[model samples]
Every structure is written in C-alpha cells, then in structure tokens.
Target: MTLLVIGGSGFLGREVARQAGRSVTTHFRAGGPGRRLDVRDRAAVLRLVEELRPDVVVNTAYVQADWVTTAEGAMHVAAAAAATGARLVHVSTDLVFSGRDVTYDETSVPDPVTPYGAAKAAAETAIKGLVADAVVARTSLILGDGDSGHEKFVHALAAGTASGGLYTDTVRCPVHVTDLAAALLELAGSTYAGIAHVAGADALSRHELGMLIARRDGLDEAALPTARQGSGPLDVRLDGTRTQARLRTRLRGAREFLAR
Candidate 1:
C-alpha cells in the first residue's frame, strides 16, 4: 500500500516511517529525510495530498510547545487526507485527559487541564469531524532507543546535567516507541475509526519509571531526586484493554521492555 507519513523525522514518526519500509513516502517541515511540507500551510497540505493520493496518511507532526502546530496543523492534514480519500492515522497523547480521573479508557471524554493536552484534545475533535474513518491513537509517554524527550530527560538527570526531581504520584503508561509504531501501522490498515488507547500494559509513576531506567542503564537510582506530584491532575494512566483486544500485537509494559 502507498503510505504517507507526516513529521516522519520525529521520535515516534521516525519509527513509523522506518517500520513502514519502501512503499512509504515521508514529509517533514524543516529538516528530515523526506520532502519538506509544512502541515500548517493548508494549501500546501492539500496540494501535496492531492498530488500523492496516498492510500493512507499517518500524521505524527507536532511541535513541543506550539499549540497551532499541534492542533490546527493536525486539522489541516486530516482535512487534506480526507479529501483525497486517504485513511488517516493521527498519533495523540494521554495528556488529553485531566488527572482527576483515576484511569482513562477509549470512551473517556477529554477534559484537558494543560495547554498541550487541550491542543491535542482539540486536534482529536477536529480529526474526527473531518475524517469519518480516521484512527486517533491516543498513546502515553513513548520510551525506546533513548532518543525520545522522556528518555533524554532521564539521561540528563542521570548524567547530572538536569536537577529536577521526579514525581512519585504522577502516573502514566509508558509504551515502547517500537510497539506503538507497530500498532499504529496495523491500525492504519484497518477501518477502526475514533479514539484508541494505545499504551503500555503497566501503569507507573514518574519516579518509579526513572528508577527503572536508571537501573536498566546502570545508573545510580538513588541519585535521582523524588517528589510528590503537585495539586494538578497527575495520573494519566490509559486503559489499553481496548487496544489489546483489537490488535494481535501485545502491548508490553515498561518493566518488560526495560528489563534488560
């Protein structure tokens, strides 16, 4: 199948493109191994989608702190893909939900407390409205290959370059990037639309995850500072039961992936 991957240079996006192999055509904004196409430019996105007419468009493009790039850009990509009759698979995050809820499922309504979360939730809403058959994969902290932002933070802390304490109460389901990419590719081929919680099987706290990483990497776990999460909603653990039931691939937990 002909596939198009937006933001193919990102941590998760890069993995998706790599796993997709030769039939995939990738797009990047500033710098990457693919053609430069800004998702923020609606006309550009439309023109590219129309020209390529890919069977599926997987949009993983996102700027860390830019709301417009995260939300509006996603809408543009989804709309263009929909117009071209391309199956869209948009990668999302668990931050969309407020920490008030103990755990979130695929059916959970988004009540984002943070700006990033709100933007992602908005993007999800826009994609659903624009693409009827789009698959919105809401995943959690992606950890693998020590290249993701989360891993960089852990590495910085371990190397004494960073000095922030990790939250003991802040909970999340950290999935391996490889597993998440594989799942997204599988979902891309299916007709499953709407939200799917594609995350790790085990829920862990930030401090706990730090310790696990430190232990796995032969770093001093005790050197890592620890603190309780603030009053804001800290628990964003996603329920991956629905994803597991839908896909043949098993979403392994952090413990399993990091237990080298």
Candidate 2:
C-alpha cells in the first residue's frame, strides 16, 4: 500500500516512516521521493493529496516550534484529509488532559495545560468531524534511540544525576518511539476509530524513569532522585483498556523502553 507519512523527515515521523517502510511502499516530503508540501499551504496540500491518492495518510507533522503557526498548519492538512477519501491517523498528545490525579479515557473531556497541547486539541477537533475514517492516537512522552520528543524528564533526570540532584516528583508514561510508530501503523489499519490513548504500560515518576535509564546505562542509580511530594503529575496514566483490546502488539512499559 502507498502510505503517505506527513512530516516523515522529523524525529517521531521518521520512526513512523522507518516502521511503515519495512512493510509497505512508502513516500514522504523534504527528501523522501514525494513533493515537499507544507500542511499550511491549502493549495499545495490539496494538490498533493489528489496526486498521491494514498490509501492512508498518517499525519505526524507537528510544528511545535511556534504554537500559532502549528495550529494554522494543521487546518489545511485536516481539510485535505476530508477532501480525499484517505484514512487519516492524526497523532495527538496526552498533554490534552489536565494531568489531574485521574486516568483519562478516550471519552474524557480535554483540558490542555500548555499551548502545544491546546494546538493539538484544536487540530483533533478540526479533523475528527471532517474525516469519517480517522483515528487519533493520543500518546505520551515518546522515547527511544532517536529523538526524545521534548522529554524534559529524561534531560532533567540525567542532569540531576550529573549535578548530584533530581526531582522527586513529576510522573509520566514514557512510550518508545519505535513502539509508538508500530501502534500508529496499527491504528491506521485498524477498524477502531476515535481518540485512543497509546502509551507505556506503566506510568512512573520522572525520578523513577531516570533511575531505570541510569541503572541500565551502568550509571549510579543513587544519583537519581526518588518520588517526593510536590513533584509533577502524581498520576499521568491514561486508561488503555480499549487500546489493549484492539492493538495486536501490547503496549510496552517504561522499563522495556529503557532496556532498548
């Protein structure tokens, strides 16, 4: 199948392309055999969509550098998906949740805390109604050998270990990029649609994840901090019941990601 991966040149996007390329004939922009088309350019996007007529359009292109530009950019992409009959897999984030002490479900109401999350939420809204065949995978902190996807916890924990201090709080479910990539492909091909939370098997605090990485890397685990009061999200675990039942590959845990 000809799968069109938007932002296939980026970190997570590249991983998605790599995973998808292993199974199907794929194409991309900015170096991949396809024409360079920005999502914001409505005319160019429409033209590219009509030309490609891809079976699946997995949108991993997110311009997090500038919030205003980011939201504007996704509008046309959503429109293009609606214009064409392509099955759209619009990647989203966990930050759309308020990070309350509760686990968010696919049906949970969104309360984005940051501008980045807000933009993604807006994009989700813009496209959900536009396309009938679509799946929104709301993922969490993506980790792997490649780009960490703005993973402050990893950096902070490593920095703390290097500096002899780390945060005791700040919890998150750090999913591996490769695993996430697989899940994206699965969602694109699956019959299930709507917002599905594809994340790590276990949600650990920043300190805990840092400790795992440190120990795995043969560094001093003691150098990392432990969970203390007033850290980060005491609980960022999203209910993955629906995802678990649907996806063939079970979502991996944070420790599994660290081992990789």
Best by TM-score: 1
> Alpha carbon lDDT of residue 230, candidate 1?
83
Q: Which residue runs of candidate 1 sit more than 4 Å off their true CA positions?
A: none
What is each predicted model's overall lDDT from 0 to 1?
Answer: 0.89, 0.73
Stretches off by above 4 angstroms in model 2 are 22-35, 146-167, 222-234
Top-lDDT structure, candidate number: 1
- Candidate 1, residue 79: Cα displacement in angstroms equals 0.8
lDDT of 2 by residue, 174-210 (tens): 7888888888888888787788888888877667777
Query: TM-score, each model?
Result: 0.97, 0.84
Shift of residue 119 alpha carbon in model 2, Å: 0.7
At residue 126, what lDDT does model 2 achieve? Answer: 75
- Candidate 1: lDDT of 84? 90
Instruction: Return the TM-score for candidate 1, rounded to 2 decimals.
Output: 0.97
